[model samples]
Target: MSHDNKTAAYFGARDLPDVIDYVGEFGAELVTFLPFVYWLYRAGQLGDRKVSTYRGMRPLYFFLSDDQLIEKDEPRRFVGYQKRTDPSIWGFIPNPNELIATRNAYEAFPNYRKQFQSTRFSFDKPLLVVHNKFNREWNSDTPVNFFSIDQLEQMFSRLKGYYQIVYLRHGRSGSVDGYSPDHNSLIDFDETSVMQRHPEVIDFEQHHREYGGGVAINQYKNELYAACHHFISVQGGGAHQCALFSGSLLLILHKRGPEAVHAYSNGFYQYATNPAPVCMIAFNDRQLQDGLGAFTDASLCQGRVMLGANGSRIANDLAPSRVQRKGQPVFGTDRTPEPGDVGVHF
Candidate 1:
């Protein structure tokens, strides 16, 4: 099977575009989302809001303190979501396999493995499931090695009217002080260094510092997650965590406005056939103005359409075949793509 045909699945409104495209580009299928709060707990951060629960049972994963995730352990018990049963929203499907995981059977089973792992083995299938975590601690690395303007445009179009954008400025340049008198930070960041590189953005350090501690910053972020339609950033790890907290989208600057097409490699978007429609907007140059210019194009407005001549067709062109073993889906059915396919691996 070609790389683009793999199915990748995930849940939650936060960075859903990032997760979908990240996986979709690499041939992944989005199976279902484990509850969002579970991600917050895993990332070791707090969120502003709680997600609605379904069927009284929520999916979760356990990550070790060392940053390695404990793959698919047994599900854990939790207090009910704000409302126990609400109408299901549009997104990834909850694991149908887990529907068979009733409380009695869940507890009765001697070795309870997370449904994420065992379901595939049941039929010798290769379904890749991912848990999207949006905490700042994990934000240091860029998700994709390269961001194409076409891909960015597609993503922005999806989130266009869907979000109210916000731009945050770090006060000074130097290692960001996690705590300070007039200086502050959540992680080690040098606002001065960043500003030295790009001074066009506005900064409000004194104003921010007066408020005191990470609490002030946390409170502001909580309010942003709670109040804003969405937050746009050159980069935003908080956006990831906030999605679980606020159920909002996180618009990231993937490619510059002036640049047209760029390269993309392994990440969540690379794993799936069709990820949720949300995505980062592709722009001509990295500059915001240039990016906004590209976004203004009517064709680009939809956000679902990728702009590249090649990258655009990669998903639709690469369809995996469906074969059933005992009526279950398996990957072997997909035929390899011809050399002319959009994302034919070199």
Candidate 2:
């Protein structure tokens, strides 16, 4: 059988294009398909089998290549897949039953954290990687799932003292191949004023422009992320990328999307990292503020590291709660909790 046929057999399907079409969204690929592919490669089921992916995503597949699963680096193609609307097609399999059973199974796979880790970008203080993007989604007039200028300022003010902040906002020119067209159109923001107001926060794009040394941008980002341990990112590919690194705290400001069910209920973010980073999902500005406050307070009160039940160093005072349990709230209160409450999954 041909490679395509073999892949179909392995996946228990016959149509490669249909599978690809079904798993069309960029985030879905990262959260599901890529991990499944990595799992297969690690299981020694795909010896010397080549995989094809979009150009900027090669760094994500580096673990497979480095492990000699593929004889040569996988072919990187341009992105032009069909758009998928149904959230049921969000995992490795198109069948929801199989997806439910196997959605979180990738957590058991080998950690991709250690494979791409680097210490080249160490800083004087603990690194705080902040990624934001302004783009239209769901035909909205303004961008959804983005940090406003006010929000960015608030976050910088709250966390700058404790961290060497690195701000990343790759506008139109930096949009990757597989991302939706809506993601490519840049919404206007006063990034200049934000940077000027917060001189302490490093503009990652400027730093990359000066020091990237003609390296592939994705690879450069992977190296930078590998060295850092804390991240605050808006929802999208950037948040997913930050979650790939182990032993970190990722606070994602996500207002609405199909990702909510997966990230919160299914515990998908836990498998994104090996030991699993402290993943916090903030649904709105208020929740984001509260989550940041919790971290800042933890930082000031107990220093940087506190031991978890697993003996891993986690944020002090932020006790591990059953936030991933469906219908549970992260922060308990007297009255009924409003929608979009913060949810933190260890």
Give the alpha-carbon lDDT of every model. Answer: 0.26, 0.57
Which number leads on TM-score?
2
RMSD of 1: 18.1
The number of residue pairs in model 2 that clash at the backbone is 0
Model 1 TM-score relative to the real fold: 0.29
lDDT of 1 by residue, 96-191 (tens): 111111111001111012222221111121111111111122123333222233433433343334222222433233333332211111233333
Q: TM-score per candidate, in order? A: 0.29, 0.70
Q: What TM-score does model 2 achieve against the real structure?
A: 0.70
